[model samples]
Target: MTAPRASIGALSSAEFLPQRVSLLYRLSGNDVPAILLTSAIAAFALWGYISDKLLAAWLIWLVLASLVRFVLKRAYRLRQPGPEAAARWEGFFCLASAFVGTAWGVTVMLLYPEHGQFHEILLPFLIGSVAMGLPPALAPSPKSFACLIVPIFTPLIGLLFTQGGAFNTSAGILILVFSAVLLALYLSSNRALIETLRFGRENERLLEQVKEAKDRLDLALQAANILIWDWDARRTNVFLGGNWAIILRVGKETSALNLDELAQMVHPDDLPKVKQALDNCLNGGESEYVAEHRVKTLAGGWVWSLSRGRVVERDAGGRALRVTGVNVDIDDRKRAEVELLAAVQREKELSEMKSKFVSTASHEFRTPLATMLSSAELLEHYSESLSPAEKANLLQTIQGGAKRMSEMIDDVLTLGRAESGVLKLNLGPANLRELCSTVVSEFRIAQGKQHVITLDDRFDRPDVIMDERLLRHILNNLLSNAVKYSPPGSEVTFSVSRRNEQAAIEIQDRGIGIPLEDQPRMFESFHRASNVENRPGTGLGLAIVKKAVELHGGEISLTSAVGSGTRFTVMIPLRPVKQPAGVS
Candidate 1:
């Protein structure tokens, strides 16, 4: 199970020689304190004997104290060791171990056998016991164990070999052979420890690789509501990705879903085309499948989606077996396309309306201009040959034609302002009775006194706030329509009265009433009732009346029965809301 050198990332890898060496020192760090305490107690017990050698003993104590401080600091560091911390701990532990080894080595000379036989055997036994204990604690890093044990034992064994005597020479040879045996044991234990660490490190590296690949795949699919599908067409089964529940919003119910179950979610209208695309690919008519369709959501609503994929596996006959691809949400793009089409359609209708209005205006203006020009030419050529009465009649005809042309132009301009939401209101107190009286008088003169125009004011109060110009147009247009559409002697009644805070006016006429179907669109510009046969009119009158009544804060309505008569009612507030600043 040893980790391959090729797979180890760097010296940072846990199985690397230096990496294992550093871990070994960290594990042995706790033993340093125990060693310090034991050594201090032993030294103190021998203090009385070593008093003459006090300076040397004190130096050893100071070095041992420094080693204790360095050991504790490195021990704290290894509690939560990282790569960088391991390297730092190794340096500190190595320095402390070397110092401890050198101090014990010095004991061979400082506490030498020159003192007595009791010291000779006792000192070597103490150092030897400590050296032999190292192999287990430092097995993870054999180089570090050698650094301490070699220094401690080499001096004793070397001295024994150099001494000139049969007994001493035999003991030196024996010590040399023991040292060789210990080295062999250390090498064998170090090999086993390295192998274990290398196997564990390799397992950690493989697990990390798997997690990273999974994370990247999840990120790619999340960006646009993507769902993966693996279809086993031959078996009529489907297996979606692990992220299927998240993408489709199916909650935990995704377990039982299959290809046929998902197909049922397709909108009815789009299902046929969707099925055809799938058939083309599955039946070998096409190599790939692509379709945009509506799919039912968890909320029981349909959302647009585009699915794309190709056949990856097939039988010997090229019969499709597996198909895999993605379904991506595309609802926003579909909505934008629909709105743009509607906007284009509206612009086309407006263009056609403008052209129709132009044609109607030209024909309306020509009749009035022709009358005025011909009347003026008659008077100019026949004035000298005719009497004063004849000349005055021609002048009256010319004046009437000029008034007709002016009224047509005013109607066009008034309708334009009303439609644009910028009607000008000259609001003030007005005599409702007088306004009705004037409109009646003008209609009587224009119709040659044939139609009877009556005004009835029933208000307790006469004064009212209103836009005078717009109010006049409301009454005049209604009155003119009544007279123009009726027989020569039909009666047109205009009544003004105060009903609550409103000045209610009614214009009634015994004329051909508006048709049943045309009443709804009566106020639309350029619209004329279907029953108005051969009536010379611009059809702008009622449209302008509707706008004028609205501007004065009033409502206008009518009731008509064909072949009977029509009655129009208008209500204007006596004290309407105040206008915006500078509005007249």
Candidate 2:
């Protein structure tokens, strides 16, 4: 064959052939029709010069060759699907086309037409018309199309030029132009067909890759037991992945679910909060929604789930149209986080209490130690020179300073026991009336006999089970504060009563009252009222009292106003449950 036209805008044969192979075999059906039609039309015209037997023989050969090409195409489709085998079939198809076209062209001279007009004009026009239509069947392989074209026209056009006349020469040149136009069209169509097939093949490869990736994603999700979900907000419908069945406590088969049905799986107590968070994200112009909530599991129990999502599609009015998110099983992580946070908070509290203890202890200890040092020095240096009463007064001052230091140490030890949760109690029968009386007497001495410390006990059998040492610490700190914080001559009343099998102790002081804001945290360790800075305190008294009461299995509540005196009521069960069950 003459050199095939340069393939413009076409894939390399290696890439194109594999995709174009089956299509080339399919073209065999179209080629047979065109060959038979052309042979039949040419036979009628050729009868003018050729004998009927010869003409019929040529037509029969074309028909049989066309039939054989069909059989080869079928076998190629079945056994020769690979590109190398398909390449051989393409060569055979092109050769068959060229052989038939050459046979038809040579007959113009071999038969030597006697009807001159039929040979010159009608015959050439018929051949050119049939050649132009060959591209549809053979265009994918441009070489095969060109093989059919040149064989039909080259000899006929050459014959026209050989005839010595202007009509003959011009007709020959016109035929050449027609052939050029036909070749250009064949090249264009061939280029388009190859490019189209390549594009389709590439598209199929991409689709397969996407399918494989989707399968991998599903496998990963299933392995992790993660549920992937998409919520169409406008439709209120949810599309869940296959793994959703693992978490959904339902039958084997499930139907479509709406947003409300999904929300129903959330714990009832947490559902309102979950809905609020979702509403805030969807309606409050926030694109993201995240929450850790308990979702009912397949066992009808709750598991903590962390759901995270964002509005991926929205309407122009800023409404959520679609939400995409994942529900990751976060039960273990959530429990761990809660425990860690509690531990961290406890550590923080201990740090603050220790810091306040260091600062307050240093200040409180320094004052009493300094006072005792001064009193001891005065007695040692001036005892002989001073009057008997002067020596006696200094001795009392030393005793008082030492007593205050002892009380501060006791409070500190009590606090340490409470913090370490190893507080030991000695339970016994104790008289509430005598307990109040004794605590008041200590208060009377500490306030220099000026403040009126009175006891009002309204109990018949005032005996109760309690640890007397903790009870004493509780009473001592309250009475000391009552005397220390109040002005001289203010009455501090201690009241004890029994009712409903619970003993209640009330300490009423006319001291500078606690502020409302400070009341909440007043019992917290290292917490002293903003108004109590002028007083000498370790900031541990109230904290120790609350711990002591809690150990006694009771609760404490306080009511106070700034500048008005504070009243503290402590209640204890008549029968305290020491080492209560589930306490640890």
Candidate 3:
């Protein structure tokens, strides 16, 4: 068996061997026509000089050799061998080449004339032409080229030298020199072909690897919900990729849009800032463009996105030519931040409310405590010397102060329950007219001639299902505030009416009304109007009333001016009672 052929450059890497073998087969297949033509011409040239039988046999042998090469080429195409079988195929090719070379070499010995000068010259010349034409076709495999040239030239040169004449000797020397030159040319051509094939295979592999890497990067970007974009500043167009369709709720056909088209999808409120940031980067005022803004989605909603980019390419004049960037979904993060800020503000406001409660409670308790103490001391020291009227007056004053303190304490506790979220509705049936009448009578008795409190019961359906306890709290505080804030003998109207399915309770008092600026926060815990100067009260009444109203699934609103008095309207939904429970 022939020794396994050495791989190209001694680099026996499996990848290189298969490629070299394939190129050898391709070059050989292309030379089939040239091989047949050359053999026919050489046979015809020598037909006249040799005996007919000898010439015919030589021609038949050459035809058989060429047929063997054609069969090998056909077999290689059908088998399609891998790298491991490369050497086997190459050896077969070299063997076929050696057979063809031997047929050519036999031409000189078979056709040479002993005394004919023309036949001698013609035989060598025909053999030399065939030998020189082979390097280009056989260059893919140096071993194959060697196999062909050695056999073809050896016979002709040996016959010339052994003739022992000056002409014969000179002819043999020149053939030897020509064979050496052809061998040199074959080696050089083979090296160049192998190098080119190796480089081409390397390039194909690199390109495949790059394509795979890009596919992986695209998948990663899609998973992360990141949108990549490229801006061609000169063309004023933007190309979007990487999850853009899913994130923007758009179609793939619209992936590329002009700058104006892209801007149209931006939120109008946020567009200016976005444009400024991009312009700054393009103008070289900033190294990178970054902005958090709202982008309008195809569904007609806005999404918050954090866009970041930089000028990737620029012209010689420093104008941006291309910008590359990515957009990350930040809608959820922005919402959380907004909620956090509101919570912080609420906490701060609660802190301030606590401080105000402490200060106001201290001052309110002092006045009532002083009144009770002074009244008690006067009765204790002057009971024996005082008349019954004087003694009764002192006792009454002490009782009044104690009642005021109890009311203040109740208001604070009610407000506390509302703030803690522990206040619940106790639903029951009650009479709207009677409840209003009761609250008005109580206020009338409490303030004798200071204010005239009137009740107008316009609600025909007075019986309704509600949280009566909360309703009482609502009415009592509103009426009490009306009577307390109004001037002496001012008319305070308490009107109860039914508006559709709701009970509307309006209490209008001609009093020192809330200031416009302070009205918005009037129901806040421990918050009082700025105009209520020297008013003897804790600021918890209206706050407690507001909370009670809310628990009853109702709303309370006020209309007020600085000197024209305030009107408070409480609208509570009239939920019907299905079962008998309790009455407030």
Candidate 4:
């Protein structure tokens, strides 16, 4: 029943006039044969009562009028005039019908017999029969029906009343009543026809609007990368629409999928979560289903999507019969969330490392400070009573404490520079064999009496472009660790060789090796092996050595066991030698 306001008004207005005209023309054709036959019968009955010429003339006029109406109907069919010419066609029809009605009126006045009782009754009855039939044929146009009916009935009724007799008066009254009823019937049928056409137009307009609205909705959903879905619980089938194939990375032919097929496309890890959400909603545990999961694409990859739905239709027993939902592409948002979490985790690790560094630095610095303080106190308070040898021993103790503190401070500064990415390599010519031998000889003079240290220089090209300071740091730390961790009389070996255009240095020691679990983080700042309990070291030696090696474009690796010995390998790429000004 709902229609546009413009269309509703036009239904009753001149907009429908063309359709009414067309209906009138078509219906009038059926009445043509009936009209001609009725006229012939009336003329035959009046033959003996009236003059042959008068009866023949009236019959000829009626036949001519009927023929004119037939011609008009034929013309209308041939032309099929549009709405613009509806008024002109309607005028022609009404005029032709009026001419026919006037011919019938002349029959009553000219052909009614004065002496013949049966003829008088016959003439009026024939005219009245024709009037009654007009309503249905011309219902679509009440004006045309009026034009035909009034001319025929007015004269017949008046003549009956003017003639003097009870029969004439009664006949006139009956004819008048019948005329009134026929007019009323015409009006009623006309109103019914208009109502039917109005409803038809409204239905058509409503259909057009519904189509437009559905098209707009489809466009909006496609632009937003959203797909609508409808599920029929009874059938166990899903209907997908609105860019579904594009968003899901599937073929357009794939518009319907069963629950099992849908589950197969979901990521294995996220299947349970998606299923649980749907079950909760279907079972009335929740009013809606919402879940984020990864869907497999045709290209053998996964993309994140957010699904939302609600049970839109239910049975009498409160069980879901149908559900409607949407799937949204959320791959970008999910990726961003993962990256944010990684950044947060990295920040947390850095904070923990900072805390550990402060605690270890405090503990390491306190020991040396205490040693220096006690040694200075002893030398100051017992200067008069102490012998020369005893005084010398206290001074040595003070110097050793200060030296240890200075070494620890230097290691802390060097590690800080390396971690901050401010450490740079100063490349120049240096001999790898000499550097190794020099470090070994220094360690022998220092602790060679306790532990045996040896250097095997196998590298043919020992003179290479390198950072001397960084190389010395690498040699000094490895030798120190080897000597310190090993028992007295244990042997340590340092070997230098060339491998694949790089210098390879290997240091081996028969020491109480690092624990397997702690070896992975051996180069981490302030991270000491768990087995090095009560060892007199700050745990920064290997950390500094790692940074120095990295600055020279090198890699360091180690192999160790808890009870067996450990070996460290450092590989540095040899820099190409620079030639003098003219050399290429």
Top TM-score: which candidate number?
A: 3
Instruction: Give the Cα error of residue 433 in candidate 2, in Å.
Output: 2.1
Q: Can you tell me which runs of candidate 2 are displaced by over 4 Å?
A: 1-225, 230-236, 242-255, 259-325, 379-384, 445-449, 576-584
Query: Better model by TM-score, 1 or 4?
Result: 4
RMSD per candidate (Å) reads 9.6, 13.9, 7.9, 9.9
lDDT of each: 0.73, 0.76, 0.80, 0.83
TM for candidate 3 is 0.63
User: Against the true structure, candidate 2 has what lDDT?
Assistant: 0.76
- Candidate number with the higher TM-score (3 or 4): 3
Winner of 2 and 3 under TM-score: 3
> Best lDDT goes to which candidate?
4
Per-residue accuracy of model 4 over 395-500 as CA lDDT, tens digit each = 8988898888889899989988998988888999998788887888889899948988888889988479999999999989988898888889989999999999
Candidate 3, residues 1-584, lDDT tens digits: the string is: 23455543455334456676787777665665676677568667766765665557655765676577668778888999987899888888888888778877776666655565564545464544655347777777767877877887898788888876877788788878877887787777776776787788889899989989988987898777788899886776789877776765654546688888888888999999999998998899999999999888777888899999999998889888899999998888889999999999989998988888888988998998998899899888877999999889888988988998898888877777888998888887898888888888888898998888888889988578888788888888888889778999999998989898899999999998989999998887788888789988777888888888888888999999988899999999988756547753
The per-prediction tally of clashing pairs is 2, 0, 0, 0
TM-score of 1: 0.57
Error of 2 at 332 (Å): 4.2
